[model samples]
Target: MKKPRLFNLFLAVNGLLLGLLIMLPILALLLASSPVEIMKLLVDPEVLTATWITLLSSFCALPLMFLLGLPSAYGLARCRGRLRRSLEVLLELPMVMPPVVAGLALLLAFGRRGLFGELFSNLGIRVTFTLGAVVLGIVFIVTPFFVRRCTVLFDGVDKKLEEAALILGATPWQAFLYVVLPVVKRGLFAELIMAVAQSVGLFGAIVMFAGNLPGRTQTLSLAIYSSFESDPQQAFALGTLLLLISLLLLAAVHMLAPRDRRL
Candidate 1:
């Protein structure tokens, strides 16, 4: 009886300490701004435009992430060679790399004088400081999360069911779409929510690669940074909005995560 009570007490204290540490600053940010400040920022044309740009860029990145990431994840889930191991490390590099470093790499690869610069120049295509650059930044930063989560979910799915579908005259695509995907939909949805959350809060990478050009490339996160010195109240309001969005995204992900990961 005493041992159980001691364990329970330890758990309670540990959880309380971490919980307070995490919640305090977020709660303060949420409550720091006045209603008038929030309303004014909400009505501000620049703020509204930046907010829309952020959402548009993030959503644009999602389809690309899903198109490329799904195949990469599926391949990783079934692969076992040294090449597979190397590819896994490569996929994880962006996640472990600093945002600034990732941004620099993107710039070097896609900027005017970058690796493919000559080819792009001949085609009359400009990538940097454009909406495409913003979308690229978001995709670069958020893709690893999407791929990693989907790979784990794909690995946990029953291979037998997919095989059964194949044996029953179903094409590979049909089997995956019907059999495997339905089972893992919840996990995929949760990962997508997390990806969106990550994309929404992206700052360093977008700023470095996309140049934070207002109306053209500036996102809400960049807007917050821009407004901080000139209009602290507006910054606080944006912060509050971001905080609420993050909280909602987290809640949605938690609710949508599969109850049985083995599924």
Candidate 2:
């Protein structure tokens, strides 16, 4: 009994230390810039433009993520055996890969002399260093996160429910839309917010694929990076804003999550 109590105490202390380790830096970042300074930066034209571009890129990537990720996730959830395991590993590769490496991979695939680069160039389309590139970069980096969460959510759904809908004369698409989707709507919404939060904070991939050009390709993350070199105070303010947005999104995700699933 004494040993068990001592172990419990040890666990509690470690948990407290871990929590503080995570919280302290966030606290420092939030307190580094005053509310007035943050507000001032928020109203600055360059900051506003960067913020708009960040939001725009995130939203633009949403449709592509939905179109590509939703089907892929559903397929993954429905699959089995070695093929499913291989596909799952493929999906996870991007998440585990370094962001800089992912960015480099994208550049290699879409740059002027890349595999499909000539095809795009022949069609008079340029992918790199544009708003389109930013959207593409966000989609490439963030879609895996969306797909992985959605796969888990879909896996929890009862296959029998889908079968019942089919027996009621619903097509596969209809069953998915009208039956399976409603069951996991709340969790799906949470994943959407998570994806948006991630997209907003993406830095390396966007910077590498789409060069940081203020009022053009610059996003909040890029803005923070650029400001850090010229003005650390402005960078701190931007970081505070980004942190607040992330916290709010995470709060919403927590609220939407099932009680047992809430973090």
Candidate 3:
């Protein structure tokens, strides 16, 4: 009895310490800037441009992520054996790869002098160090996060439900649309919010591939970095805003998650 009680106490103490470690810096950042100052920063042209670029790039990446990630996730969820393991590792490579390295890899794959460089050059399309590059970087970095979560959501769905719909004269696509999707729609919505939260905060890859060009490729995270050396206060304010957006998106994700699956 005493062992169990002591272990519970130990776990509680450690959990509290972990929570504090995570929350303290966030609280400090939130409080470091005054509301008025934050508002002023938001209205600044540079800040506004960065905010717009961040949002635009994230939104642009969403469709591509959905089109590409959903099929990959569904396939991953249904697959088994060594092939599944290999595919999972391949899919997750971006998440584990260092951001700078990922950026370099993207550059090599799509840059003017890259493998497809001549083809893109002939088409008069430039990829690197542009707004398209920003979107591409976000898609590369964020797709794995979205796909992993969605794979879990897809896995949780009952195969029987899909089978039943097919037996009821539905095509595979129809069954997936009317049956499997509805069951996981809430979870999918939650994952979308999570994806957006992850997308908006990407810094290193976006900077390396897109270049931190103000009013062009610059995002809120890059803007914060640019402001930090010259104006720490402004950076703090931007950080606070970014943190608030992330916290709100995360809260929405939690709310949308199924009760049994809530974290």
Candidate 1's C-alpha runs over 4 A off are 1-10, 261-263
What is the Cα-based lDDT of residue 61 in candidate 1?
Answer: 97
Order by lDDT, highest first: 2, 3, 1
lDDT string, candidate 2, 8-117, tens digits: 99999999999999999999998899999988987799899998999999999998998999989999999999999999899889999898888889989998888889
Residue 205 error for model 2, in Å? 1.0
Which tens-of-lDDT digit does each residue in 1-263 have in candidate 3?
54668889999999999999999998899889999998998779889999999899999999999999998899899999999899889987998999999888898889888998899999999998889999999999999989988999998999999899988999999998899889999999999888999999999888888898999999999999999999999999999988888889999999998878354
Candidate 2 error regions (>4 Å): 1-4, 261-263
Worst 10 residues of 1 by lDDT: 1-10
Weakest lDDT window of 10 consecutive positions for candidate 2: 254-263
TM-score of 2: 0.95
Q: Which segments of candidate 3 are over 4 A away from where they belong?
A: 1-4, 261-263
Distance from true position, residue 218, model 2, in Å?
0.8
Candidate 2 global lDDT? 0.92
